[model samples]
Target: MANQREELDGSLSVDDPILSLRNASVTFDEGNSFVLNDVSLDLGRGEILGIVGESGSGKSMLAEAMLDAIPDPGVLQGEIIYRPDSDTDIDILELNKNELRSMRWEQISMVFQGAMSSFNPTMKVGAHFRETIQAHDADVKAGMSRAREALADVYLDPERVLDSYPHELSGGMQQRALIALSIVLEPDILVMDEPTAALDLLMQRSILLLLEDLKEKYDLTMVFITHDLPLVAALADRMAIMYAFDLVEAGPTDEIIDHAAHPYTRALLNSTPNLDAPLEEMRPIAGQSPAPINVPSGCSYHPRCPLADEQCRSVDPHFHDTGEAHGTACFHWQQARDDIELNYKASVSANPNTPARGDD
Candidate 1:
């Protein structure tokens, strides 16, 4: 894997960001509530940027907003800038319908969540590939060749897969086919939402390996959205943690794993099961994630945060630089590392042997 953060000590961010989201917000009910709020991040070319959080954290919404694919009545606010190269800057939200049609699939393609449902059941896999390519006005004959090439790239035999319906393929095969289809157009950026969420552990690992291969083979930049932290940690060059529609923390994968600056980020890391660590060390986060419609005031994560105080209850926090290109949105980010460790030590000392409730 490439160490994009190696130069972080001297730079605040990537020298060239292929995609940028600036103060992006999405609302399904006008401005009454937001599914995504004030999200801002950058994706460097040829790098995988993983967006991870629990359900309802706006990871999918952020992905959809990037491609202007938000469903009916969902309004997107702020800028989604796509810089294909140094010479061009395209405001995604400003693009007309025709322009958008031309841009999608060719420049930015999405492998949506739920591979089983993402395809047309009645259509053969080849038909799906054919239609997608045809819609973009590419020659059907050439497109079929590209489709076959894509299938082969993902290790799927085009001969069997192209003729089969979505239901005909196994869960893992369906996912591999979906990935193949996403790349058939050879887009510069690929936005994949939970591509491996439905697969078994072994299959999931296989799919991730395939993705890593694809990333290198195609020189693809990817925005991977998922709820699994450990899974993303293995694949993403950098990780961004979102909470209640807000981006809580983002940094290089190594930096975030080694020294997470936010309480929520630490909680997530601790929550994951580690075979190398004692079972007692797996501490589940204390409370439920806040509901989107009823997001808490001030810091959205404060209600569940151990370090929250009066200020955290009344004033929202912005991203504070935590060095090495890491930025966390927490008023007590400076104190998080020690405080969380102290709390964990106290909890383990008190229980000693009892595993966390869900471990059973």
Candidate 2:
């Protein structure tokens, strides 16, 4: 089945995406060790693509690689094609420093994780906004007006938030400020790296609502990166699952949630608690994710997967399409699905209070 965005929005198409990552890889100085493996995905115009994974799964690195901001000592390779308009296509990795800087906030912007650390404590919020706008060559007077408008759009009191220092605002306020800052330039696409990870449940909920509002108000194409599966599932039109450094699975949000083909994706689902189901049915994924430097050979997930076999342990598996819009890089996806069904039935039967699994 096609994605929700495709069905509802005639302008968005997967075939000619707004952003396309092709064989994109990020590596540090270590030989043969990658921060992000050859990961490729697409972001359609005005669609939210959720990239979810455990920490150290290269979610942030992938976001950095997308914008040619992979930090010093890290090298990025392959293509990151960006389409500002139907006729214009630019490879982000190939752009010169000046060209890249010109494109960063004006076309593609990011809201980094950890709102507290993102701001300079000594500087007033307005000062940070001024710097961002000034860097992009906007005049000081006009910049402040734009900043005020942006803050107001996020539901913050523009004057109060602009006058206060970063430490003066609560965690939630700081996050909202960050969102305001990222969209101040009115970028076509937004890359958010765990923007709500530090907040409480209430704050997270508010941020999610704000994000939805912003997406529609700005007609923004978004890449939302986080470790929270349910949170992403709630907001995203499509989902991508990353493990160790590779993109293990990606498909429509409902499809991946209902019929996850990869064992790692299933493990994550099992680990997450569902309010409608019995708490006893929830199970944590066994074993820790391997460190990037020492990632396991063959399939990186083979070490922790219950469905692993000799082939899975000895050879890397490429993406195998399981449905029209779904793909998994698992040699035993069919077996994994069968096992997941059996386990799910066993758990629900053991606890009659558990809700039946919903359709994808």
Candidate 3:
């Protein structure tokens, strides 16, 4: 019944969470500015956590941070605590390089965006799978079998896909192959960043269903990262809204779709294309996101928020929770929650699963 977890430290509790990112932030160019600021998230066992945000919202950066995949020149701050099961908890951010490498692909795996482009042009699809499986196994023959089984799981013909190169396959096929490879190990947590970014509407739906089946089949926890809210709501049990490098809102998917509290969340939902609405009725969120180097004082979103006040412009907002895990970073969340919901609901689509509306 508690709203905000006020007393709880940012660590992952072994009881529930498979992975927890606590007060996590990312900065680049030698601490010149933060690309991701003061973000915390929890992915529960067997649950899909959707990270919804815009291009500049650092959703991908947060995903990279989770897997300790941030490249050189970027600095990650704070803790990434992970508990693969009930018996152990480890702070991933503090892990040694070797440990990070070994933990990933074995316990956690990532299905990155641009799978079509991600595969090596020179390597055949089968070769790629064999290499991945062989890296962890001494038995090359057994690894190939596992790879074919994974391909079958994703609805791809194991023989055709393995023999083909990435370029030889269709975009969706290449994507499915990449997905097959990621799940070949059956990692406990699958972190997918925009898995359907390249596919058409039909393929997107196919991938979505494939993901649902994979989660249930493998008993996996999932973190789905994308700029698409409706897509996330379609499969995710819980959702988080990220903006200006901060996690502004976290709640149930339905609540976020129907009763979002943060201004950014409201504006995002309002701006999203309502498939149920004609093109003429659609309206986009006004104002642009401030540059990471030039983030605004106080509430970073105050400039675009219609409900902004003197307090909003000058004093930063902290999250105010509604129940247990649902909360928003907004000074006027209590006052604006109902009005925002009413106004947006009147103008927006109720169904979050409505397929692509094309960005505004």
Candidate 4:
């Protein structure tokens, strides 16, 4: 949906978005390994798209592909299209080094995980802020002023952070400082890879709240990548679930969180510790995630799936439409959900204490 609100920086958004990944796949080791397979996703002009999955689930690779940061033996296939406006379009995969460099901070900026370690220790914090401005050709006074403003936005003391080195700041402060740096240039889209991964629960909540405020303050379209489902549900407009390197399901955040169709996604939601649910009934998924290098044939999730049958093992599943702009890569979503609902009913009947699965 096109945003009706005023744009951040008073800029205009194209009514139609061409910013999307269409069948984008990434492989390494001379194409011997596929880390991401046939992932197709489109970003709305001003919405947060959350990608969530377990560790080693290719979530990081997906972000790298968006930034065209893959190198050497890594090969990318299909298209990463960027259309800033209706008048122009660029295939991000085809850009050369110089061309890509110009677009990096100018159009898209990324906030890496463990933001504390991303800084250069040799330089004073202020110098790093100044250097970022220098790269964009802004003058010293303006950059410093903006740097202070950015820090203030993240609730950090600008003067202290500017003078101190990266090591002087607490982990959470450093992360907020990093986030400040990311948005200083006012990029259209901000891709955050596990931005709150290292923080404690309270800090995570605070940082996430800050992110939500910043998104509105800047009118930012964000790509929030993490394994934290509830976190994403709190911030993202829409979300996608990845499994075995494939984009398994995606929809509006509430829909995906409350009415999930994919088995893996259901398993994930069930596994989450819900305060409303009886603690004794909450269960984790049955098996460990598969090694990507040795991903199973047909459906990689089949081996661990409780509902897997001969058909699930032998035939690859294609995305089945569940709602408008929502789909799940599962052959039995309809039947599965029905059976699960029946089971939940039976359980509640038997115990009178079972909690219903009320999630995506």
Candidate 2, superposed: residue stretches over 4 Å from native: 1-13, 341-360
Off by over 4 Å in 1: 1-13, 342-360
TM-scores, one per candidate: 0.90, 0.90, 0.90, 0.88
The residue pairs found clashing in candidate 2 are: none
Cα RMSDs of all predictions?
A: 7.2, 6.9, 4.4, 8.2
TM-score of 2: 0.90
Backbone steric clashes in candidate 4, count: 7
Candidate 3 local lDDT, 1-360, one digit each (tens):
011333442221223888877777788878877888867677788888889998888888898888888887889987888887668889887788888887788888999999976799999999988887777763778778888888888888899889988888888888888988987877888889998888887788778778888888888889999887876787888888888887888877777777787878877766667565556555577889988788888888899988999998887776776664567878888677766643333423234453432111
CA displacement after TM-score superposition, residue 345 of candidate 3 (Å): 6.1
The lDDT for every candidate, in the order shown, is 0.82, 0.81, 0.78, 0.76
Error of 3 at 27 (Å): 0.9
Q: Candidate 2's residue-wise lDDT over 1-360, tens digit each?
A: 001121212112286688987777888875456888877777888899999999999999999988989987888887899998778899988899989998998899999999999999999999999999889897789778888988888878999999999888988889999999998888999999999899876677678777888999888999999998877777888889999887888888877777889999988878877654568888888999988678877888988999898998878887777875888889999988888752242221122231221110
User: On residues 200-304, what C-alpha lDDT tens digit does candidate 1 reach at each position?
Assistant: 776776777778889998889998999877777778888899899878888888777778889999888788764445778788889898776888878888899
